[model samples]
Target: MEDNIKDSKQLISEIQSQYTRLSKGQKLIAQYILNNYDKVAFMTACKLGETVGVSESTVVRFANTLGYSGYPKLQSALQELIKNKLTTVQRVEMSDDFSDENVILNKVLRSDMDNIRDTLDGIDNEAFQDAVSKILKAKKIHILGVRTSFVVAQYLGFYLGIILDNVHVVRMDMGDAFEQIVRVGEDDVVIAFSFPRYSKKAYQLVKYAKEKGASIISITDSLFAPIASVADNTLLVNNSMASFVDSLVPAMSVANALAVSVGMKEKDDIKDYFDDLERMWEKYGVYE
Candidate 1:
C-alpha cells in the first residue's frame, strides 16, 4: 500500500514482502511477472499463465492477490507502469486496445510527445555540455548508425556539417563501416545511434573506436544496451512504446540540441567556415 511501490522494482519488492502468503501457483505468477515485467505488460492472462507454467484461472487469482478486481484491471495497471517507463513506440505495442486505428494513432502521438517531455526533464545538461565540448575539440567526428537509425545519423551529420568542421556521417554498408572505423584515431570522436534490435555493426564500431583510442558518445535505448558498455558518454532514449517502428522525434531533438550547443561553443569558427564556403560558392557559381 506504499505510494512508493509503483514501479516494477517496487512491485517486486511488494511481492517479496508478502511472499510467504502466496499459494504455489500465485507465487509462480508473481515470480514470472516480477522477472519479466516488460513482457508481462504486453501479454494476456492466458499467455501469461503459459509463460508462468500456471493455469489461466491461477493467473486471475494472482491478480486478485495483488489487490486487483480482476486480471484485466491488473493488466491495465501493469500497462500503465510500462507506459510510464517505456518509450512511445514501446507503450503502443504493449497496450491492449489496438483494434482501433484512430485510438492507436492518438496513443502513439501522445506517447511520443510524452517521450520528448520526459527526455527533456531527465537529460543531464552538464553531461550534454561535456559531449558538445568533446565534439568541438575533436579533429574529426564520425556519426555512425545502421538500419533505421541510419536516417537519424545522416540527418545529424548533415546538420552538423553545416555548422561544424570535419563532421562525417558514415552510413555505408556494414562492411565499409569497419574500414571507416579503422581510419578514426585518438583525436576523433564517434557519436553512435542505436536502439532495440540494435545493430552488431554499431557495437563493433564502438569497440573499434575504443581500441583506436577515439572517444565514443552513444545515444541508445537503455543502460543495459551493449553500446553503453563502451560509451564514454551515453544518452539514453526511450523507444519502447509501439511495435517495430523506432520513433525518432526525441532522438532528433537531442541531436539538434547537441548541434546547437556545439555551434554555440564554436560560434566564431562556424561563422568563419560559413563565410569561406559562401565565398567559394560565389567565386565558383556553385549555387547556380
Candidate 2:
C-alpha cells in the first residue's frame, strides 16, 4: 500500500515540481488537476480547457509543458494515479459511453488493438532478452500471479513447464504463498505478474523473493508499479481500459512471446521430449 501510494503520488509530485514554471493558463489547468484529478482524468482536452476557462490549445500546451506528448498522455497518467482506487461500479460509470450496442463490440476490439500497438511501441527489448536469458539459466523458476494476472501466469507456466523441468507456478489456494518460495536463492528466478488494480500479495511475494536473493522479472503496466521496484528485469505492457473489465490481450501477448522465445531456444531438446510424450499419450489414448 505504501508503494501504491508512492506510485500515485509520483505524477502529482511531477506536476507540483513544475508548477512554478508554468504559464497562467497552464497553472489553471494544473490547479484543476490538483484539485479534481479524478474528474480531469476522464475529461477530453476541450472539456478540460472549458472547465479551466482556457482554450483547448492551452490544455494541449499544458500537457506538453509537463513533458507529455499530448493531453491524452497526461490524462493517462492521471488515470493511472486513480485506477487502482476506482471501484468496479465507478469503472462502469466512467465507461458509460459503451452503452450503445451498435458500436460497443467494435469499440472494445479496436481498443484492444490499440493496447497491443502501444505495448509493442513501448516495450523494452533489452529487458525482455535479459529475462529470457535469466530464465534459461536459473536453477529454479517461481512464477506468481493472483487475480486477473493469475490467468497469464498460468498460461506462461503451462508452456514453460513443458519446455523446462524447473518451472513452479506458486499456488495461492491454501497455505501461505510466501512459504512456497522461502528457499529461493541466487540461482533461482521469480517472475511476477501485476497490473492495475495491482495485487498487494504479488508485490510482497516478489519483494520477498528479491530479499531472499532470487532474480526478479516483473511484467506490469507501469514502471511505477510496486513489483517494478523489486524486479531485476521489468516488462511493460498496455491494458485496455475502455470498459470495467480491463482487456488482458497485451499482457497475454507478452506472455505468449516469452513462452515462444523460450521454446525456440530449447527446440531441439523440446522436440525429443514432446515426441516421447506424444508416443506415451498415443499409447494410452490420452487425446481420444
Candidate 3:
C-alpha cells in the first residue's frame, strides 16, 4: 500500500482542494485543522471531534476525505508536519494543551513510560539485529549526536568503548569533530542520535559518512527523520512529552539495549576487557 501522505504542504493542499466537496461536519473539522494543525496532531479523533463540535466518525471521514487510511494515519501525517518545524516555545505551548490539567508529576512520568512502551512495541527486530551486527563487524564505529542528544551519544559511546575497540565519538568541543570520522569508509559504521529539532551538523556528518560508504544506524523519533532517510538501519524511538522538555527515556533505553546487545555478541572479548579493567581498577584503588 502507498504510504500515508506526510508532507504538511501536501496535506494542506489536499484539505483545501477537497474543502468544497466536504460535508458540513467535515468542513468544520477541516477548518479547525487548518487553523490548528500543530495542536490537532496531538489530539485523538474523539477529542478532535469534541473540540470541533462533531462526531468521532466525522473526524475519521475528514481524514479519509484527505486520502488518509484513517484518523491515526492522518494525525501521524500532521505530527510529521510539525516535528521539526515547531520552535521550543511552540512545543511548550502544544505540550501544555496535551498534558493533564492536574497531577503534573504523574502526567510526566506516565508520558515517559508510554514513550518507552511505544518505542519498544514499534521496534523492528530485523533492524535491531542488523544494528548489532554492524557494530560488531565494523572496523570502526563512530557515534555522532549534538545538543541535547550529545549526552545520549556520550553515554552509549563511553560504554561501547569500554567493551569494544576502535570506538569514536564526534563532539564539537573536541576540535575538528568531523576529522574524527574523516577516515570512515565501507568498513565503518556511524550510529547517530537525532530527535525533534534535530542537529543539522550531525545530519551533514552522517550524510558525509554514508557517502563515504559507511553504514548508517539512526536512532530517532521517526522513520522520516533526516538521518533515517539515509540510514542503513533505522531505530525509531519515542520521545513524547508531557512538559516543556522532550523525554529522552526511550532513546536512552534503546542506546542501552544496543550497548548490551553488542557486548553480548562479543562476549569473550568484552569479558576479557572488563576483567583487565577490574585488575587496573583494583591496582589503582579506583573504587571506594
Q: Which candidate is the best by lDDT?
A: 2
Clashing pairs in 3: none
lDDT of 3 by residue, 1-288 (tens): 234434454887878888999999999998999999989988889999999899999998888777777887787778778778888888777765545557787777898998899888889889999999999899999998888898999999999998887898888798877778888999999999999888888889999999999999999988778899899989999886555687889989999999999888789997888898899999999999
Error of 2 at 213 (Å): 0.8
Q: Which 10 successive residues of model 3 have the least lDDT summed? A: 1-10
Worst 10 residues of 1 by lDDT: 1-10
lDDT of 3: 0.86
lDDT of 1 by residue, 139-185 (tens): 99999888888888998999899887699888676457777767899
Residue 270, candidate 1: Cα error in Å is: 3.7
State TM-scores per candidate.
0.70, 0.86, 0.86
- Each candidate: RMSD: 6.9, 4.0, 2.7
Cα lDDT of model 2 by residue, 1-288, tens digit: 122324345788888999999999999998999999977888889988998899999999988877777778788778888887888888887876688999999989998999999899989999999999999999999998998888889889999999999999998885989889999999999999998888899988998899989999999988888999989989998884888988889989999999999999999999999999999999999997
User: For model 3, what is the alpha-carbon lDDT of residue 233?
Assistant: 86
CA lDDT, every prediction? 0.78, 0.88, 0.86
Using TM-score, give the best candidate's number.
3
TM-score of 3: 0.86
Of the two candidates 1 and 3, the one with more favorable lDDT, higher being better, is 3
Any runs in candidate 2 off by more than 4 Å, and if so which?
1-32, 46-55, 65-67
